[model samples]
Target: MEAKSERAERAAQNELLFRAVNEQILQMTERFRAQLSDIDIVCECAVASCVGTIRITAEEFVRIRRETGTFFVLAGHEDTDVEDVVGRRNGYVVVRKQAVAADA
Candidate 1:
């Protein structure tokens, strides 16, 4: 079993990676303002092996960015022990990592 701290570290790293991908996608999307619609974003789950992507509208992504602790993951990717489901969409779920993990 993974230790709590290790899990938190992994989760934090995944979140950071997801954020980086999001930023890249945002930059690319900005160049096509007239065609902007649903954007593909990396699933920000703690699972290091996960390579899934979630599609969300640009507005939804902006709302998630308003809060640092929140993340968008595939519908079933949430680790209940380290995060809580704050919202649900058609193909994805919004999770807010626990304080300890969120701060990592």
Candidate 2:
């Protein structure tokens, strides 16, 4: 039936979209990993939350983080934590810089 064919077509299109999004995320994550290899990397959803080790300076990190995205609806509000958003969306890789401990 025409209806059945239409539904199938829609499903296929949706699948393709999903695949594209997944690929984008994978690519971005890989780039982040490579760029911040000196630090730990955690792939997380914007809501679920994760951590990564970052060797870059705080200024650099802040700049990179700001450039990440201007809009994050999944984060639920303005000034939402990037880690939280990445965790919720499961669409971004976060690079966290671990705090160094002072020697005793």
Candidate 3:
């Protein structure tokens, strides 16, 4: 069986992929480049079946990325066993992995 730490690491890695994709999306949008426009990004949840969206501005996204192990997920999608709810905002919440964030 996969260890809890391992599972948490894997989940964080999955969230990282979603973060990368969102970053790419923000970069591609001309409007967001000039102003802080809100965009719908895929939720960075650990669950494979989750298809939730997070509405946040590009500036807010950049602020979230400034911290290591931090990820943005849809409201109520946080995994308390592996992550902690660090911040709450409209439509979503920010989570910080409990540990093993660097593995990703």
Candidate 4:
């Protein structure tokens, strides 16, 4: 239905915005060479109102970023209708947007 596509589009836009923010965070972290044991980054969820943070190491984030269009979110924050869980860590999970499913 049209409503579902609209929801998916909205979710994609929100997630993309968060992903861009997270990329900036990573750039800052790498530029400073902070060597932090763990960094608190915003949850890359689709919820526009979500202000949650997920704790993860710089290296871990880089590893997850190796894949295109992936996001890191809190375990229960993932919306299966929009993304597919690709990896799971202690407190977070990596997800990839499902092209067909999300648009369906």
Report every candidate's CA lDDT: 0.85, 0.32, 0.83, 0.84
Could you say which candidate leads in TM-score? 1
Q: Which 10-residue window of candidate 3 scores lowest in summed lDDT? A: 27-36
Can you list the residue pairs that collide in candidate 4? none
What ordering of candidates by TM-score runs from best to worst? 1, 4, 3, 2
Q: Compared to the true structure, candidate 3 yields what TM-score? A: 0.84
Model 3 lDDT tens row, 1-104: 88998888779778888888788877777455666487778898887667788888878888888888888998889999899898999878999887745365
Error of 2 at 11 (Å): 0.5
Cα RMSD (angstroms) for every candidate in the order listed: 2.4, 16.0, 2.9, 3.0
- Global Cα lDDT for candidate 1: 0.85
Clashes per model (N, Cα, C within 3 A): 0, 18, 0, 0
TM, every model = 0.89, 0.29, 0.84, 0.85
Residue-by-residue lDDT tens digits, candidate 4, 1-104: 54766877888899889988988998877766665667788998988899999988888888887777688998899988768998898988998889943454
Question: Which regions of candidate 4 fall more than 4 Å away from where they truly are?
Answer: 100-104
To one decimal, what is the Cα RMSD in angstroms of model 3 from the true structure? Answer: 2.9
Q: Compose the digit string of candidate 1's lDDT tens values, residues 1-104.
A: 98987887888888878888898998889878579888898898887788999888888898887886889989999988888898998989998878844576
Candidate 4 global CA lDDT score: 0.84
Cα lDDT of model 2 by residue, 31-75, tens digit: 566454333222222322223221323233334445332212212
